[model samples]
Target: MTYCVGLLLNEGMVLLSDTRTNAGLDNIATYRKMFTFEKPGERVIVIMTAGSLSVTQTTIARLREAIDDKDSTPDQSIMLAPTMLKVAEIIGNALASVRLDIESKMEASKVSTSASMIVAGQRRGGGMRMFLVYPEGNFIEATEDTPFLQIGEHKYGKPILDRVARMDMSLDEARKAMLLSMDSTLRSNLSVGMPLDLVIIHKDDCQISERRRIEKGDPDFSRMSEMWSEALRDGFTKIQI
Candidate 1:
């Protein structure tokens, strides 16, 4: 299990993902769940994945291969796709293909191969867009009505987003919301351990504005988490109901 979340706001976008992957209580390890591709002033793409590690890793590998292939077309490579929508399609198709291939080989074992991804990016002349791509090559875009997308062990972290996320929030606020969301997931679920990966991309920049990796016991994150816990406790005490 894992947790990854992305927010698309009027000012920019913020993304976060945990690095822990576990096969069992005794077999936990860290593998980055966030990946980025960029063409600096032309385009930028960020993908956060969850579910079967085999499927997600293979899909990402194939996508990179397509980008490097001399014969690749827009339909076959996300970097060559003309629109964010088309990029989502390319990623979805790749994920579905990889999942199916892995599942077939694991059929005799009856192991599951389900996976999903949050695809977010901007083209030089196009609008910023975000999509939650499912295992079957279908996807849903983020809109004003729903300015955020999440995958993996998301339930524990969704309430804060529901209450405070806004399409007009500043980049700083978006980062805070994203971090708080991840903080919540970490406290509630052991499967979603840290060393987190965070990315920020400002509107129309077509490139990553900031990136950071928060390792376990990071001072700033620890302070923020402590502050949030205290504030919540204070609010709980003040509630008349």
Candidate 2:
């Protein structure tokens, strides 16, 4: 399992995902969960995945194959999709197809092959959009009422987002909120480990504006985690019943 979150605000979008996959106590490993497709200033798409690695990897692989196919069309390639909604549809279709293809084989072996993704991006001349794609090919868009999408081990980190995230927050603020949210999850879940990938897409840029990889024991993240723990403790002490 893993923890991934994306924030869609008026400014742009912020995405973060952990790189951990644990099959068992002794089978833990790190595999990046964030994938990006972009054409410089023309368009940018970020996909952060959680669940079965086979499903997510195949879905992404097939999407890339379509993009690089010599005969790829606007409807077939996400980079050339006319709108962000089309981009999500293309991804949703790919994910659903991959999951169905693998589900039967896995069922024969008594294992599960299920996965989900958070898709966020912008096309030239279009506004930024974000969606949480379900395992069955359907998805829900992030709206003003709920400017965020989360997948995987999310319950531990959702409170901060519910209380603090806003549509008007700056990109920097959004990034901090994501890190703090991840910190909360990292403390509570063993399945979600370190080496986080973060991506920021500035509205209308149609490309990734910034990206960061936070590895285990990174001083800055460690410090922030410590500070957050202290702050929480202080807040707990200040409250009176």
Candidate 3:
């Protein structure tokens, strides 16, 4: 299992993902779940994935191969796609194609080769956009009504986002919301362990504003997690119910 979330806001975008993948109690590993494609100042695209490791890795590898191909056109490469929507289409198609190929080989065992992704970014002179792409290549974009997306062990972390995420939030507030959201998931799900990948993009910057990896022992994250727990306990104590 994995956990990844993306927030789209007026100030920018905030993304976070855990690095753990667990097949069984004794079979666990760490693999990057976030991939970024950028031509700094021109375009920036960040993809966070969940589900089958094989499916997500191959889809990303193939996308990189397409970008490097000599015959690749603007439509064929996410970095060159005219708009963020087109980029989502290109990624969705690539993902579905890869999944079909994998599904064919795994038909006998019925091991399940499904996967999903969140694609978020902006191109020069264009508004930012975010999409949650399903295994079949279809996707849903973030809207004012729903300005965020999540995949994997999401249920454990969704309530905080539902209560706090807002389109007009400052970037710092968004980051804290994302962290607290992740904290909730970590407390409830053993499969969603850290170190986590965090990326922030500022509106119109067309570049990643900041990127950080929060390791298991990171002081700030530890402090924040402890504070959140204490606050929640205090709030509960104060309530009549």
* TM-score list, all predictions: 0.98, 0.98, 0.98
Question: Would you list the rank order by lDDT, best first?
Answer: 1, 3, 2
TM-score of 3: 0.98
> On residues 1-241, what C-alpha lDDT tens digit does candidate 1 reach at each position?
9999999999989999999998778999999999999999899999999999999999999999999998999999899999999999999999999999999899998777999999999999999999999999899999999999999999999999999999999999989998999999999999999899999999999999999999999999999999999999999999997
| Per-candidate RMSD, Å | 0.8, 0.9, 0.7
Alpha-carbon lDDT, every model: 0.96, 0.93, 0.94
Would you give me the overall lDDT of model 3?
0.94
TM-score of decoy 2: 0.98
Q: Please identify model 3 stretches exceeding 4 Å from their true place.
A: none
Query: Candidate 2 lDDT, tens digit per residue, 88-127?
Result: 9999999999999999777768677879999999888889
The deviation in Å at residue 119 for candidate 3 is 0.4
Give, for candidate 3, the lowest lDDT window spanning 10 residues: 74-83
Model 3, 1-241: lDDT tens digits are 9999999999899999999997777999999999999999999999999999999999999999989998899889897788899999999999999999999999998887889999999999999999999999999999888898999999999999999988998999999999999999998989999999999999999999999999998999999999999999999999995
Per-candidate clash tally: 0, 0, 0
